[model samples]
Target chain A: MTAVLALLEFAPGTGATTGFRLVDPAQPHLTVTDLAATRGDGIFETARVVDGRVQALEAHLERLAQSARMLELPAPTLPLWRDAINAVAVALAAAGVADGSIKFVLTRGIEGGQVPTGWVLGLPSPDFTRERAEGIRIVLLDRGYRHDVAHTSPWLLAGAKTLSYAVNRAVLREAARRGADDALFVSSDGYLLEGAVSSLLLRVGSRLVTPRVDIGILAGTTQADVFNWAELQGFTTGYELLTPGDLATADAAWLVSSVRHAAPVRAVDGVERPIDAELTARINAALDGRID
Target chain B: MTAVLALLEFAPGTGATTGFRLVDPAQPHLTVTDLAATRGDGIFETARVVDGRVQALEAHLERLAQSARMLELPAPTLPLWRDAINAVAVALAAAGVADGSIKFVLTRGIEGGQVPTGWVLGLPSPDFTRERAEGIRIVLLDRGYRHDVAHTSPWLLAGAKTLSYAVNRAVLREAARRGADDALFVSSDGYLLEGAVSSLLLRVGSRLVTPRVDIGILAGTTQADVFNWAELQGFTTGYELLTPGDLATADAAWLVSSVRHAAPVRAVDGVERPIDAELTARINAALDGRID
Candidate 1:
């Protein structure tokens, strides 16, 4: 028998303990008619768990609310989400998980239903230790949109971070097929966007730069936290319109996300790029110190 | 208490009659862990049922297969899909639904599961009779991609009809807010693509023109069927790159889909356009005659 991936699960409004249900990951839970299942009409957030504590819980909750608003879904209360996450976190700790990830999802509910369906699941954090230690080889894939698309086309839901991530997943698969560890999506008109599962971060001398969120990319919480700490450490932080050329010329580049925190980009499109081991360490440490 | 929308639900492989389990639409049937509800990693098809017969059933199945291939999902055999559709059709007929729609979905299944989860649902066809009679007002919205996006970027999954339709749904909602009936998506480079929920068809002079499928648009099964029949009826059909101006100058325009057949466009962006009632009737007749 295969081991279940999800160690803990919680669904609100279900007749379970504390309005959260303990679900066996092996069984079917979601009906086939859910709008989330059928139309990908939903929002989700994945936050890291460290020593039984959810990292950047407030930030994740705020982003979730923003995503829900962008999807025109009724924003779920922070308390409801907090309680559910706590419930799942408790269960994960009880299962002896010291480090893991908690994923919260709010779907448009079943088709024809008015209320949204919200749930939280806790799973073991993926082993990104190697990437963090040795860095990653990435390829720049075209995201097929100009940088100004998000500003002109709001319906594209550019930065909303909805559940329609099949494209993102596919890009990573393509990267793997091409003998790369991950993919960094560049805009059609030659601008660096973000990564499939992480945000683009570049270090050039004492300056730290990331792409502007207004250019149709998700606002990376971890990137923001690292930038705040970097600024205090005498490193100038700025948001700019970057390109593939910018990535190739940078002293170092890293993909930053909540769970992995910061994974350095050691190469681009199979070409070996510069890697600042000390800088990567400092940034990861800064992220770790700030995220609570 | 409000009534549930789905009339009949069928999930294969569950212990039930005919490998399908009857579901109560009001209750939650999906677990919190299904990838379909979480990532929207799936493909779907909606086919019309006229007098208890699924129209364009083979075409829909073929498209579903194509979409699954694009998503790198294991395609289910035709016989399996046929059995599931037959089961749902029987259930719908038993419920006295002579004219309805059947929606079949194939999700990537749970987070770590290899087998895909498939289901069929039957619902009463929406009353598009009024729209088909009086026609519909449509707004031209930017799809935020160039016409060559699909050819240049396969990761965008442009031609594949996946479950990530939130943006499409949002476009229609925006159209409704703008006092329009539907939305026709124009490419970022000023080329007519397709409709939010249907394909774009225009009657210009003696020729019938539809946007080329290479323009990051789902190849319309209904449009293909209509064009095939139109050729036999002395109408020259061609695929070309079209613009909104072309739509404004056409003698008639339509948003065609399997369930609604062909709905004539009465206006584009609040500007009234000519509607050829005779042409619409003839085209719909052709579609009805060809689709089985």
Candidate 2:
């Protein structure tokens, strides 16, 4: 098998998911009416796999459950999902892949069916060496929402890792057209938000700062891991209502995600920015060395 | 078949889509990796089918092409799509369904496969008699975007009929929780926008008004048809930047869509609003009496 796939099966009567079954990754297992395919009405999380073990498994699952709650989907069985994720990770490792990523999805299910559709896909990871080491150039794009929207308009599904990411992908393309590797979304009212697919981490001297999570941004799993690593290394970690000026004045910055670990932001909107290579390497090392 | 399904096939060598092939609607056809299933990276258009003929056929096709352009998908061969849509509509008609609706989707395709995945699904229309004559209760929800977001941030894809509609679905749930039958989205700056799955149409005396299309709202196809019918009947029509005050002030209001036709707004945000029963019936009749 080129990749590992697991379909999470739920017991209709009791509303308890039994577990997952492995499937051929190449086969089509989704119907057209599945909300995940038709309306992007679902939630998902991707975690990196290393040495046959999933990294930050609990964190990813926690975020998945948070997203489910936001989307009003059935709460996923964490222990069962944890087992399934590990199984997919182990399967990829058995296939002799050193590094892989597994993405687990929980959808609203077939339209009108009410029973949720869920899956875990495991595939060998792409070489993100260039992104992790040399760093990524980012362009700031308007997210078109206020930073406080998550509190005011929860129906907008802000801060939820839902399947409706067409805008997220579109901004990346826009960033590329503007000669950047990635895009950081700035709230409409002028606040630094988050990356299109990752979380923004800034180093301002001895303090490690991320945009306040209340500002309608995902609570980044990798960013939290880095914060834990930073704390042990005697750095102060905090979240703040950051602005573009904060990004410009910060000593260094990076976009952190589960799959990519930590990618330093070398430039913003075409201007070269400082990269904390030593701290970056240490952060990645701590993340990569995770035994969980 | 309970429903009609048609999958479009593209000629890879020539970069031309030759035609479409019928498929069993019940079978699972979409792979997990398809961008539509993962990222909601797609566009769609729903059209009403009456007596085997698609209402506002050219209008729907034009909107589909317009959405493809906004999403940067390959320009669909409209004639091929037109034929497929008509075939699906005809098949559903042949199945003894008097009033059916067709939803055509164009996705960015499977991850890394530049080819687009497209299909037309035809299903019998739901009974909207209660919604049409009795009218619907609406709640105003903040859409979390400035009215000019479409012009300011095209990446956000306001005005495009994208499949990334989790928010669209979420707001309806919010509306339901508020004991309303439907929801009308308002811009962050408090300007009235459109419905979750339909367009807002207001009757101010004899003239018809819809939210200006430039403010990141879908230009309603049925609303356009109604305008044509209105002009023929000696009523003037226009587009304007409206507000909640407008909804309260208009002589009558309706959330117009393809499948549901004209659903009069008898209430807004728990407050009873005026309903022009005579005009509402005439408009629905005009929409239903379409020859094409």
Top of the candidates by DockQ: 2
In order, the Cα lDDT scores of the candidates are 0.80, 0.92
- Where model 1 places Cα greater than 4 Å from the true spot, the runs are A1-27, A289-291, B1-29, B289-291
lDDT of 1 by residue, A1-292 (tens): 2112332222444412224455675565566666788889998899887766888888888998899888888766777578778777767877888778888887777676665666778888878888887999999999887888888888889888898888888898899998998999988889999998789999998999999999999999899888888898999999999988889899899999998989999889999877888878888777666537
Evaluated at residue B28, the lDDT of candidate 2 is: 89
* RMSD after CA superposition, every candidate: 4.0, 1.1
* Candidate 1: pairs in clash: A29-B30, A29-B31, A30-B30, A30-B31, A31-B29, A31-B30
The TM-scores of all predictions, comma-separated, are: 0.92, 0.99
DockQ of each two-chain model: 0.59, 0.92
Interface RMSD after interface superposition, each candidate: 1.9, 0.6
How would you encode candidate 1's per-residue C-alpha lDDT over B122-236 as one tens digit per residue?
7878787788878999998998888998888888899888888889888988899999999999888999998887999999888999999978888898999988888887889
